[model samples]
Structures are given as C-alpha cells and as structure tokens.
Target chain A: MPSLIWFNEDSLNPEHQMVKDYADAPKVYVFDAPYLQAQNIAKHRIQFIYEALLEIPSIQIYKGETVAVLLQLIKDLAISEVVTTETPNHMIKGWQNELQKSIDLVTYPEIFPVTDHSSPRRFSRYWRKHERSWLTV
Target chain B: MMQQLRTDLELADREAIATYLQSEFPFVEDSGELSPHVGGRTAGLVRLQSFRLEKYGKQRNFLDGEVSQLSPYVSRGCLELEELRQWALKQSRSKSVEAFVSELAWRAFFHLVYEEEGDRILKDMEKPKVPMNQHQRSLPEDIAAGTTGIPSMDTLIHMLKETGYLHNHARMYLASYVVHFRKVSWRAGADWMYSLLIDGDFASNHLSWQWVASTFSTKPYIFNRENLERYAGSLLPGDPKQGDPFNYSYEELAERLFEGAYMPEPSGRSPGQYQ
Candidate 1:
C-alpha cells in the first residue's frame, strides 16, 4: 500500500519526522479555506502559511475543504496510507475524524517533546517532574 | 472544489510568493510581502543559530530587548524547541539558557493544555478571579482601527497589524488595556490578536489573554502608569498626567477597573506564570 503524507498547519517544518521518513512518498498541504474564512483568519495568517509552504519541497498545495481534498486524492491517487503529524487544531482534528471513516489516519507524535511523561494540569507540577532531567539530560 | 496552487516558479523571492498568494488565494487580501520572518526549514535553522541566551534573560522584558526573533518559525514548527534547548545547553549549562528554555516551556505548557484538555483551552479553564460579570464581549472599533489616541495602546495595535509581532511587554499592555481597562472580554482581544499575528498560536495567544483577564490564573495581570512608563515610557508623554486612560496609580486603576470589593492577589510567580 502506497503512503500519502499530509503536512497539516501545525507541522509545516521541513525536517518533520513524517516528512523525513516518507521522503519519497507523495505529500500534500491544504490551506483549508473554509476553516480560515470561518475562523476570521486574517490575511497575515495566510501570508505566513504561504511563506512557510514555500519551504516544503515537492508537496502539492491546495485551497478548499480539507477533508474533501484528501478524500478526492485518496480515490484519484489510490492512496492506502494517509499520514500527518499531531496537532491540537480543532479543524484538523475534525478532518482527521472524518478521514478515519474511510482510512486509518496516521498521526505522529508532536515534533517538540518536553518529556515522554504525561503533563500535569499546572506547569509547576510538569516542570518539577522534569526540571532536573531537563537541566541534566 | 479543491483548487491546486500554482507552482510554476520556485517562489524563491518575496515578489514571487506575493504574486502566487494573490493568484492562489484571491479571497485573503494580500498586505504586501510578509515581515522579514519568511518561513522555511533553512530560515528556521538560521533563526535558532542567532539565540542570545545571556542577553535574552535580562533584556527580554523590554520593548528594545534582544529577541532572537525565532517566534514565527517556532510557532510554525519550522524549528524544534528541544533542538534549541540542547543547543543552548551546549553553549553553557549555566543559568543563561534557563530563562530562554523557560519561555519555550511556556509554549510547551500551552501545547500540553490544548492536547490534554482538547479544545477546553479555548474556554475559561477556571472562573474569573476579578469580577467580570459586566465586561463587554466586543472589541471596540477604536482598538481595531489602531486609533485609540492613547499612544502606547495605539502603537501596540499598529505593531500587531503592520508587523504581526509585538514585544511581550507590549502584548501585556495592549491586552491589559483591552481586557482590564476597556472592560472587554479577553476572548475578543485574543481573537483579534490571534487573527492578525504572524506567529499566532491559539494555545499561546488565547491562554495568554486568559492570563491577563484572570480567567485561567490566580489573579488578573494589571499594569499601572509607572509600570507602563518604565517599559514603554517613550510611547507616553513626559508628563504622566497626559497619559490619558492609563494615567492613574495602581491603587486607583484597580479601584476603577474592578467592580465588586475583593482582595487582590500580588500576582506572584507560579511555574506556569506567563513572562
């Protein structure tokens, strides 16, 4: 089964683990126009994302409904594996949930990991768990 | 329909990106080329290399502080926080990098909150510390227009619009003026700021506003004329009396701003304390 890597807004880094491991796979990044317009995302936000997209090489960029784009591509490209990095974005999560109905979406762990352990509600507790390790390791 | 963006040119220069964006996204009005912080993995790497840990600790709080300017890349995930922390430690394990690392930790903390709470961060995590029963939920037209006539507030709004960047102090002052002085909900200010910022991250921007509004913290983050003048004195006039709006002392401002009679906390530092 061929893999199709999708770089969501949160993980646009060229050196992202998914981008690295699937270097040879077909990749795409969507602008999610509906989400942007609905959220009242300013022009500057799009400007910055375009600037970032200019960096990621060989990825197909599109503007429209995100899930529709991915679903169309899945049928058009015969994509068996859909991969992307993790994000807390409400829109992206919504699309991922929709995508899962048709395909098993692969979400890698976040790019930046403070600690492998789970975080407490407060930063103090989270820091206390790893400050010594953070300083030393 | 999902329309594919044109990739005819390499998009190597600002002119190309601007032209491409105009053609590809006609809906979003092009505001000319972005600030010097263009995105790319290579740019992110270069930005990380310029961190001044030693100076960042002390000067980071001021308007003219020595910021690494790595915010756009960091927020976009063009650069990894762990990589920067390792690089800083390699420079020197001394307390220099600790402050810089803590700033990164704040972002991480927000990220964790978003991940764990799953959209809960968008709403108030805790009840309002100060009485906000009657606070307006709308952002004033003057604020969005950047014509507040208060020099400091106006300048901050202009910075956010023109450059999509604001000094942490400037952000606090602007947020305080909106959430506290103007008596508007932090959500309104956060939405307006988040929409305009080039480095806008929901977890960071929204949560920070909640911090200022005292929705997610033990106390509200308030500032007086002295604190504002100390950090952004240049924006204000020499005569403190001329600083309309924010001309009062801390006590007076608190009395005027807060509604119900309640004891004020010193806003002491917690591990999660913003800035």
Candidate 2:
C-alpha cells in the first residue's frame, strides 16, 4: 500500500528523520483553510509556509478542508495510508480521528524527546527535572 | 487530479505566491522589504551549522549581540530545540553553552506549558502577587505608530514592523515597557507583538508578556536607563545626557514610573534592590 506524506506548518521538513522510510512517498501540503482562519496566522507567517513548500519536491498544495482534501487524494492516488508528523494542536488531533475512519493515518513522534513525567506548570520545576536528560546528549 | 493543480503552481516563485496570496486575502499585509528571510529545511540546516554558540552566550543580551536568527525556523518547526541542543553539546564543553542551552530550555518550557494548559495559557498562569489595575484592552495608537518618545522602544517598534523580528532582549524590554509603564493589559501588548513577529509562537509571546507584567512571575521585569545604557547603548540615537527621558537612575525611575504602584525599596543586603 503506497502511503502519502502530509506536511503541515509545524512539520514542513521533508527530510525529517521519521520520513526516511517513506522517502519516495508522494507528499501533499495543504493550506488548511480552517486552521488558518482559526489561528489567524499573519501574512508573513503564511509567506514562510509558501516559501518552505517551494523547497520540497512533488508536494501538492491544496486549500480546503483537510480531511476532504486528503480523502480525495487517497482515492485519486490509491494511497493506502497517510503519514504526517504529530503536532500539539487539538485541531490536528480531530482531523486525525476523521481521517482514520476512511484510511490509515500514521503520525510520527515530535522532533523533541517527550518526557515520561508530567510537565510542571512552572518552567523552573520542569527544567530542574528534565535539564539533565535534555543536556546529557 | 492533485498533480494537475500543483502543476499550475510549479512555475510560481515566492514573489508570485506572495502576490497571489495578497490578492486572495485582503487581510494579508504587504510585507515589502520587511519580508522574513526565505525558510526551507536546507536553509535552516545550514543556519544551524553556522550558529556560533559561544558568541551568542557572551553577547545575546546586548542589542548588537551575535544572536542566532534561528527563531523563525524554530517556531516554524523547521528546526527543533532538541536538534539545536545536540549541536551545541557537540560544539563546546564551556559554561557558555549552558547559557545557550538554558535559553533553549525556556522555549521547551513554554511549549510544555502550552501543551498542558491549552488555551488556559492565554490567561494569567497564576494570580498576580501584586494588585493589578485592569487596563485598556487595545494597544495604544502612539505605540503602534512607533512614535512613543522613548528612543529604544521606538526603534524596536520600527524594527519589529519592518523586519518581523526583534532581538529577544529588545522584545523583553519592549514587552516590559508596554505592560508595566503603559499599564496596558499584557494580552493587548502580546497580540500587537504577535501580529508582527515572524517567529511568533503564542506560548513564548503571551507567556513572556505575562512574565514581564508580573502575572506569570513573582516580580515584574523592569528596565532602567543604566540597564539600557549597558546593553542597548550602541543602538540608541543621540546623547543619553541630553533630553532623553530614559536617562534616569534606578531609584528615580522606580519613583517616577511606577507612581507608588510598585517601588524599589533599598535593602541592606544588596546595593541595588527592588521591593
């Protein structure tokens, strides 16, 4: 089953370590109209996204509902699964739920290491506990 | 089908894309020369490779410091905090790297707060230790127009509006001045700054404003003339001894600026103490 890599603003790097296995996979980057409207992202930030997309190879840019666009692409390309990098956004989580019903949706871990312990509300407390692990190498 | 749609855009460069977006979305401001540098995975990687951590640590607080202009990449997720940390660790064993690493930790901490609290981070993280006057909700017109008599702040506003970037120290100073001196709500100041910053992350921008406003921290972060002279003297226009309003001692600054809402009471322990 050929997979399609979906690139969002948070994970635009095509050469990300997680995507190495799917190096030859066709990638799609969507403008995510709903997300943009919700976020109220500035023009400069949007420009940054456009410039980044220009760097990656064979990435199709779409401006619409994410799930609808992905579903149509899956049908058109016969894509068995959609792989994307995980973001902390709640909207992405909702999109993933809708997406999983029709096709396989695989999310790679964040670029940073996730801590096992619950993060403290204060930065000092968080840093005191995680600094050693973070700085160890 | 998707391929055909992309083929139409395949020939488009950044300028064409910007033009198309601007025409389609009227809210999108024309960035002009203040347009942020082109960011891609390859460019971000190259920037990371060339960053000088030692110089960054030594002078990052100064206006003309050797700051790594990598925040746009970091905020956009082109570069990761963990990746930068690993690079710093490999490059040096000096304490300078500790300063740089701690800064990275701050970014990570902000993200952690945002992750755990969600939209709650938009409000005060904790009840402010001091009494706070509920201030205006909107950014002042003068501040927005970059005509705020204060030299350093006016320069920062111009820079932020034009470049979509301001040095972190300059950000802190501007944020502190807006929230504390102007008595504006941190939210207003945060929103204004967030709108222009190319590297704006809600977690960092909002929480940092809260920190400066004393909503997120024990004491408000304040800067005086002497402090500005030490860090941003080179960037300030004209003589400090002339008609500059910022040219005042810490005690005078505290008395004049805070108006008894907050004051720097001298303690026997330290030469310069704020209470």
Candidate 3:
C-alpha cells in the first residue's frame, strides 16, 4: 500500500488517469515538487518525503543526487523495509544494509516474466522448458 | 513475506528462493552467520557501474574477466538495481552507457513479467503448445569441462567454471552454442549456468538464455567458432595464473578504471591480430 510513490509532477500530466483514478483514494500523496503551488509535506509518524532538485555539474553528481533523494525518501517514509530485485549491482544492497538495523527489508524477485512476485521460479522454469512469451503489462 | 509468495508459487521454484535471499539478506561482510537459508553477498553495485562505464561494451567480449564480476554481489542482494540505475544515469550521457543501463533494465523487464503474470510467464506457449523436448539432455563431462574442441567456447566455458564469471559477449555466444549448435534446452543451459556461476541471477541468466534460445528473439542466434576465436581475449586484468587471482586483481582493475588512470587492453587480440 503506497501513501505516496514518487511521481514527476512537472512531467506527469495532472489530468493523467492514474491521478483521477485514485482521486478519492486515501493514504495517497502526490509530490509535484518542481511546480509546487503549495507545500506538500505531510505529518506522519512513519514516513515523510521531502522533494528537491539539485544543480550538479556532472551526470555522476546528479546520480549521487538521486541516491540522496532516495535516502531522503527512505527517511521520510520511515521505511522499515525495502524491497527490490537482485541484479549484478550492489548500491541498493549497501543502502539496505545501512538501513537493515533500523527495519525489515527484502528484494522481491523482479526478473519473473510475470509481475506477481509469487511464481518467479515456476515461471522461469516454465518459460525455460516451454518457450513461453511473457506478456508485458 | 517473500516466503509467503513462494508458498503461493511451487516447490521446485529455486529462482524465487534465490531472489528472496538476494533482496533481504544482501551481502554485508558482517551479514550475520552463514546458513542454509541465506545466499551469499549482493554488494558490488558501484563496482559494476565502474565496469560498464569503463569497459563493458568496449572490451567485455575481448577480455574474459575484466568486468566487475558483479553477478554474485547482485544475486546475493549485496547490490541493488535501482541504485545502480540512479548511479549510471548520474554519470553517463552516452548511448553506450545507456546500453549498459538497459541491460539492467532487461533484468527488470523479465522480473516485471513474472510480477504481472505469475505462473503464466513460465509456460512454454503464450497459450499452451505441445512440449518441444520434455526429455532432458545431459552434456558429457569433457564438454561440461569446456573441452568441446572449440577454443572460443571452451575458453568461454572454462572461464565460467574457473572464475564463476563469463564476459557478457561470451555469455551470449556460449548460450547460443548450447541452444542452437548443441541442441540443448535453454533451461538445461540455465541450470548448468546456475550451478556454476556465483552471480547467476534468474532474470539475467534465464532471460538471456531465452534470448539465445531464440524463444525471446525475433532472429535466431548462432555463434560460430570463428566468432569466439576472434573475441577470445582474457577478461581479467592480470593473468589468472597469478596468486589469489580473483581476490588480488579485482581491486587493481577497479582502481585503474575508476581513477581513469590507464586504458586497459581491448577484448581478444590486438586490432592487427584480429584483422
């Protein structure tokens, strides 16, 4: 259940269907930070996301900025648990450990042909055995 | 919670189990005590980034072990994909960089499918078709030992076994050989790979296998022996014969590349040699 998953306000159409689809949705928050006509901070015991953009001379610096923002998101969300897939990379792993002492975290297998998070192995097995074309949603 | 998802899946689904260990226990030097329940380390995201930016596309096929060997790290949850993406986006503006970034995306794409459809993604047919080759096939120990009489492939397989890492280019070639030339199922190849590769990830390993099997591709893949010979440069920075090679040279490669100190050799032979 997401109270607020980061959405690019300046980029995402305000009239986009997902926004209206959950217009009446509760525990949902939106951060159109770049075009904030008003403050978007919420007072919650668990998580509080603060959105900001930084000026960086290099793309690497910008990526560091993104990580910084993510760190902030984790702090704001009071995210006791983090979930993601394992790839041949490790920054998320590093951050997860940094946060593990403070919370529970797990990586949902993201490589499954289906997104259910339930049948990754079976789905992989089936595809490997049967030559199935996975549907993309 | 992840186990609950597994309970909802099937008994033999090892990939799900692998993913759970990766995401939850990701590799920390102090990752508590090792146990049957836990897989190994996942940390190596930054190192992987350095590998791609510095060498992957340019030299991955040529050199055998120069890449970061990040699979084990990622597989064990010592690394995370999103963080790698964020790091990559920040550092690179080139399409080559983007290509490396998309490779990671490819991993996500397969996972996304599994997340969406569950058991359906694993099916042989989109709608169900007659099984192509339900009977399993086994490779001889010699072939399995990378002595198939094909130098490039043998080198590729040899590297995979000895180092638990194969260059991405070599990975594709070896996979294609097993699927098309040897007439092996991609799953069988995947199983073999999973057993040997320390970094074997279901998404990258399986999906890449499918791509090689031509099940996921619009075009068939075939890697002739010549292609392998031409690209058969070592991937490691130093010789494997050096002492404690895996442990010793990785940091050197990382340092040389990250500091932009020196340009490493390109894959396989020198330009004149290949020509």
Candidate 4:
C-alpha cells in the first residue's frame, strides 16, 4: 500500500511537506485535458506549467482526465493513499471527493492561513486583522 | 489511460516543452515564440531578487511601473506569499513595502472569497450596485477581436493576448470599458481576461472585474481621458482626440453611461475614480 504524491498546478513546490514526507513515493503531475478545455486555458499558461513540471525531475507528467488517470494509477500500483496540496478550485475539490471514496487522501493545508469564516468581508479589515501578525514575524 | 508526455525533464528545455505541448494540445494557440517570461523556481527567485520594493508603492498604479510581475509565478505555486513578504521586509519597512504587501494581501483576500463563494464567484455575488442586467450576456465581435476603436483598450487587449501580461491599472480600465461603456456582462469580460492572462487566477481576475463592475464592491470604477493620459502616458500616442469616448470628465461619462441612475458628484485628481 505505497502512497503516491499528486502535484497539481497550485502545489508544484518540490520543497513542500508532501514531497518531503513522500520522499520515495511515485509522484505524478497531470495536465487535465477536460479541465483545460473547460477553462479554455491557452498556450502561455500551459507552457508556464510545463516549465514548472520540468523543475521537479522526479514526477511523471501526463495529459489525460486527471481523476480517472490518478485512480487508474492507484489501482495499478496498489496505492493506498493519495497526497496533494489543498487548492481552492471547485473542480479540484470534485476530484478530491471522487478520489477520497477509493483511497485515503492526505492534503496539505492551504499555503496561506485562511478559512472561510475567518475571511473579512473587506480587504481593509482582512489587512487590519493580519497586518501586525505579518509585520511582527 | 494517461498518455505520459514524452519529456525527460532533465534533458528537456523550453523548445522541448513547446514541442511536447504542440503535439499533445494542438487546439491551444501556439503563440509561436511561446511565453517571453521564463518559468521554473530560478526565474521566480530572480524576479524576487530584482523587485523594487520602494518604487512599487509610489509607482505601481501606472502603466509603466515597478510592478513585480510575479503573479504568473505565484499563480503556479512556484513562488510563495510568505517568501515574497520576507523578501520585501529585508528590502525595507517603508510605505512601499507595505503597499506591495497590501497588493499581495489582495490576492489572498480574493482566494478567501473564492473558497467561501466557490463557483458562485463566477456569478454576480451581490446585486450590482447599478442597473446592468440588460448588458450583453456575451462578448461582442469588436471587443472580442480587440478592434474596440478605443486605442488604449485595444492595445491592452493585444498586449494581453500577446504577452499574457497587463498592468493592473490597464486591467481596471479594460474591465470598466467592457462592463460600463460597452454594457457587456462582467462575467463575459472576466472570463475572457481570465483565460488569456498568464497570471490568471479565477478569483483575482474575476473578483477584480466584479469590483470594477460594482458587483463585488460599493461603487463601479471608471476613468476619464485626463486620468488615462496621466497614467497610460507614452504607452499610447500622446495625441488624444477630442471626440474620443473617454475624453470626457468623470461626471460627463457617468451621466453618459449610467444616466438617470443615482450617482455621487464627479471628482478626480487622477486617471480614474470609483463613484
């Protein structure tokens, strides 16, 4: 039941905890075709992601339906857990929901310390709440 | 089954990446030269290293300013917000750094809202502060094709498709023209802009358009010719025509666009104002 690290666009950092904890895990990055078509992502954005994937030499890159591909990999490789970063994308959330039914998922917390309830209605208030804490540190 | 992209990350360079992309995704526009901005952590760090923390605050609002141009990296998660903050601190604690930090905070704020609102962020979150339901539900040919007659806006649109980068103020100006002047739905303009930007985050791009449209904020953002002249300086031909649509003052433009709607008194010391 070896684990696999799934790197999404928002979670490309190889230095992140997931990459560290799953040091020997088989890592994968996907260019989700349906998601790209649905979002109408163009060449410039895709090239940037491709360049980023080039940075992490260990991850296997693919172009396909992301959830189906990851699930297939999980089944083929006997992966018991799928680890990834918590991205706020609703589509990614849907993928997580689908993937979770089949295997345990370890999601890294959002890069920034924020929760739905904690967010202020206005940026000014949000800044006021977080300013000193940010400045002091 | 996933088609594993045939690329050896260590052996491949930009050309190799471009080749693979061309083969795998033929439908996407192959903007021949690919992106001018290089990706990877090294490029992101170099950008961070060269960032002018001081000029950022005073000049960030201009078309040609010391903006970090880091959004592309940040959006891809190649750069972290904390790293940016810490780097800015080492530069200085002046108002410029604070201003730069505030800008960064703006993106996170959008994400916070995005998390809360989910896909609803794509829709109008609140009643638009003005009457705009009649605006075009879809983009028009001229605007979509970037032949909108307004030179500044058309130039911005060309720059958007070509470079996948635009000054934030240019974006506001474009959004205002699309949302208010053309009377198109903010959603339409937002989706178009979001799709093209290299730094496009659905939350930041969409929410900013919503802010400009007065759907997410208290008032709609608009700019006049004189204001555009000050900031857009030299980016356009200095010879602005008298009959140009944006040549009017804020008061005149507001009356022209939102006539009969309740609007505050017109006033501005700059290129644009939110009323």
Evaluate all candidate structures by whole-model CA lDDT and list the values in order. Answer: 0.75, 0.73, 0.41, 0.80
Compose the digit string of candidate 2's lDDT tens values, residues B17-68: 7776776556665657536566676778877777777787677778887778
Give the number of the best model, judged by lDDT: 4
Best of the candidates, DockQ: 4
Q: Which stretches of candidate 1 lie over 4 Å from their true place?
A: A111-118, B29-33, B234-240, B260-275
Q: Regarding TM-score, does 2 or 4 come out ahead? A: 4
Error of 1 at B40 (Å): 1.5
**Clashing residue pairs in candidate 1, if any?**
none
Candidate 3: stretches off by over 4 Å: A1-137, B1-57, B64-68, B117-136, B233-275
lDDT of 3 by residue, B1-275 (tens): 01111123222343443344344323211122222221222114335545756555565446543455554444433445545556656764664455445555555656555445443333331311112263246654655777776555676676666555665666776775676556566677776775455455445666667665545543234433344445654332222343321122323432432233222243422121100
For candidate 4, write residues B71-143 as lDDT tens digits: 8888888888777777776775798988877777788788889888888999988888888979999989898
Q: Count the backbone clashes (under 3 Å) in each candidate.
A: 0, 0, 55, 1
* lDDT string, candidate 1, B116-218, tens digits: 7777777888999888878888899999988877766777787778777777778888888899888898888999888888778888889888888888776
Candidate 2 chain A, poorest ten consecutive residues by summed lDDT: A109-118
Q: How high is the DockQ of candidate 1?
A: 0.59
Determine which window of 10 residues in candidate 2 chain B has minimal summed lDDT. Answer: B266-275
Question: How high is the TM-score of chain A in model 2?
Answer: 0.91
Candidate 4 or 1, higher TM-score = 4
Please rank every candidate by TM-score, starting with the best: 4, 1, 2, 3
iRMS values for every prediction? 2.2, 3.5, 18.5, 2.1
Which sections of candidate 2 miss by over 4 Å?
A33-40, A65-68, A71-80, A90-104, A113-117, B1-17, B34-36, B238-245, B251-275
